[model samples]
Target: MIKAVFFDFYYTLCVWGQSLEPRLRKITERYGFEVDPERYVKARENLYAEASGSDPTTHSLLGTMQEIIGSYCEFIKGLGVQEHVEQIAWELLQSEHSLFAASAATLYDDAIPTLEHLRDAGFKLAIVSNWDTPLDPLTERLGIAHYFDIIVASHDERVKSAKPDPHIFNYTLAKVGVSAEAVVHVGDTYEADIVGARNAGIRSIKIDREG
Candidate 1:
């Protein structure tokens, strides 16, 4: 029997608002980068996909920030905007980070209700996310923090490893006081969430909301 349940954060429990594009545009303009909105979005998507597969523990927050800045610089350079690429990338990073830190992502319609039901059913709930930002504040802001027994973020000192590395999952399992065989994880990403959970010897469910 599954005694504990773990969930992924972004795209699984909550989604970014429609203002994401406008916010991106604002940041790009503020940084003096002449980027086509559509192309920028596609580039971001591709970069994110590539990043998700790699191990996040290899870089500290500062290192990751620098890496992101470099990626953005290269992306803009490819777009024929070569001057001040580094400065503009740094500005864009700061602006996007602030935007995300503020109010941007909203909880899914079924998120709260499902969590409530799971908690009521006596299952220990936790959030295991491969995220750099703290999950506590975001979950609290979303009003779903109470339902979770723990929130494990990959960037945290306790678990520097991201999903698919198994370190984060092992940490979460230990914190939840549940054996891997007794827990079930649900997430959207196949490579990160599903593979990570499996590597930790935990069962997993992939929730494909769009499909």
Candidate 2:
């Protein structure tokens, strides 16, 4: 019998669209500067492309934000928006709370009820997320933090490796004090969740939100 269930955070337990706009606005406000949201979007997209690759460097949201903001400042100068760049940086620095707000991402209607049912049925709960930001506050915001017996965020040095690496899955199972055969994982990423769980000798369920 499966005694425990592990879950992935983004796309599995949550969903969002255009998540960066709020922070972009906050930055603009702080700097007393303005730019077409579309331009900022382009800059952000460029930054994402620059930071992304197969080098296997574990990713962090906070670090990415810093890089993206810096890139945007330089790009804005090219676009003649240099005066407003510091405002953007200042806003980003002050808007950690607002950025955290994006973490909600509208949990699936079935997610909570399913979690409650499983918990009541004696299933141990844990979260194994590949996020650069601290997840404890976001879990508290979701009100389901208590449901989890353990929460592991990639930001924690203990999880030096990111998804697609079985280290995290193995570590989580170890923490829950369960054997791989007695645990199951649920996540949205085929490579990360499915492959990682399989590598760790655990069964996995992939949630396809589009389906």
Candidate 3:
């Protein structure tokens, strides 16, 4: 019997109001750089894939921030904007911080209902996300924080590892006071959430709302 349900944040329970492309475009424009949005998006995806595949536990918050800035600079350089790479990177980072810090995510239509059902059913609930920022306050602003007993993020001080790595899952299990056998994880990312939970010896369900 499953005593707890762990959920992924982005694309599983909630999604960002604005994706990276538009934000990137906005920043580039502010800096007088003309970029191909498609190219920029592809570059970001490639960089993110590489970063996400690595062991996040090896990097601290500052290290991660530096990595992001470097990735942005690489993309900007690819767009022929060689000047002000560091400045642009810093401004872009600040923009991102301000944006997400404002809690610009919206819950799915079924998210609240499902979470409420599970909570009412006496199942312990938690949010396990790979998000770099603090998740508790964002969930709180989304009006669903109270439904979760634990909110764990990859960037959390206690969780230095991201999904697809068992460390984050292990930390969550410890915090939730449940064995992996007693919990089920639901997420949209197969490699991250599904494999991560499996690696942690927990059952998992993949949810692809689009497909």
lDDT of 1 by residue, 1-211 (tens): 8999999987688876533355556666776765675676566556555556655567777777666676767666655566777766665555444233447667778998899899999999999987766778888888999998899988788787888889889998889999999999999877788888999999999997544
The list of candidate 2 runs beyond 4 A from truth reads: 17-62, 66-104
Candidate 1, residue 153: how far the Cα is off, in Å: 0.3
Candidate 3: tens digits of C-alpha lDDT, residues 156-185 = 667778888898999989999999999999
TM-score of 3: 0.70
TM-score of each: 0.73, 0.65, 0.70
Question: Candidate 3: misplaced stretches above 4 Å?
Answer: 18-48, 54-62, 69-101
Clashes of each: 0, 1, 0
Ranking by lDDT: 3, 1, 2
Task: Please list all clashing residue pairs in model 3, or write none if there are none.
Answer: none
At residue 209, candidate 2 shows an lDDT of 66
> Model 2 misses residue 32 by how many Å?
29
> Which ranges in model 1 have alpha carbons more than 4 Å from their true place?
19-49, 55-60, 69-101
Candidate 1: pairs in clash: none
- Model 2 TM: 0.65
Candidate 2 residue lDDT tens string, 87-199: 65545444432354464356677889989999999999999876766778877887889999999876687777666678878888889999999999998766677877898
